[model samples]
Target: MTEPPSLKKEPIGRLISYIHRTQQKRLSRSLSEYGIGGGGQYSFLKGILMTPGTTQDQLTCNLKFDKATTARSVKQLEAAGYIERTTDPEDRRSHRLYPTPKALKFQPVLQAILDEGNAKLTRDLTDEEEDQLIALLQKLNLEE
Candidate 1:
């Protein structure tokens, strides 16, 4: 027996694209109520919360985002009072990013939103399957 042409074609790209779109739509809707925009601001929030005092350049590098996009996201986050920028003592021209009290206060809510999305994604999988899927994803995403 032969598989269908669609099924026989590259599966990873389609699967990943579908998952990305689904998560983006759901997360955008969930985070909009908190005043976060449609882009991946939640990820940046989590990044700053986890690693305080990182600079905008660091964020751009760490997030693999372009300079302009990172700058825009930082500006939006600052405008919304979720993050603050302090002058980098080492580099007078650069500034360090930090999560504000408002962002810290809402961290749990943001985490819950992420957890809910993960749960939805894995709702049909068993614990072992979920673990296996995560392992496979990590393996595939490993940097050279």
Candidate 2:
């Protein structure tokens, strides 16, 4: 009997790439509608929302972003009126990041956009299939 082709030679990587490309395009368009660029903006907002008054170093470690990247993103978000940086009282050298009321106001809209995108991506999947896929993904993040 002939052996089947190796999994490494299969089209899994291409399929994954296509999925990521399509999602990126969709998210890019959706975010553009809100006048926001993708990437650091989203994470910055999420970080501030999750932990108000978090220091820049804390964001760097929590988001796994380099110090310069975190600093730049925070600055951009602050300039965009999405966040504010206040001096940390305990530490004169550090600044704590906080989301502005303007940023909080868009939380529901952002959530709706994300939900819609998720729905579109999972349109053909059953509840059980979705659960299984989520479990598989969680399994991949063992360190989490």
Query: Which predicted model would earn the best TM-score?
Result: 1
lDDT of 2: 0.81
Q: Write the per-residue lDDT of candidate 1 for residues 45-126, one digit (tens) a residue.
A: 8899999999989888898878988888889999999999999999999999999999999999999999999999999999
Q: Which residue pairs in model 2 clash with each other?
A: none
The residue pairs found clashing in candidate 1 are: none
Residue 88, model 2, lDDT: 88
Q: Tell me the deviation in Å of residue 133 in model 2.
A: 0.8
Regions of candidate 1 where Cα sits further than 4 Å from its true position: 1-10, 141-144
Task: Return model 2's CA RMSD, one decimal.
Answer: 3.8
- For model 2 the TM-score comes to 0.78
lDDT of 2 at 73: 79
Top lDDT prediction, candidate number: 1
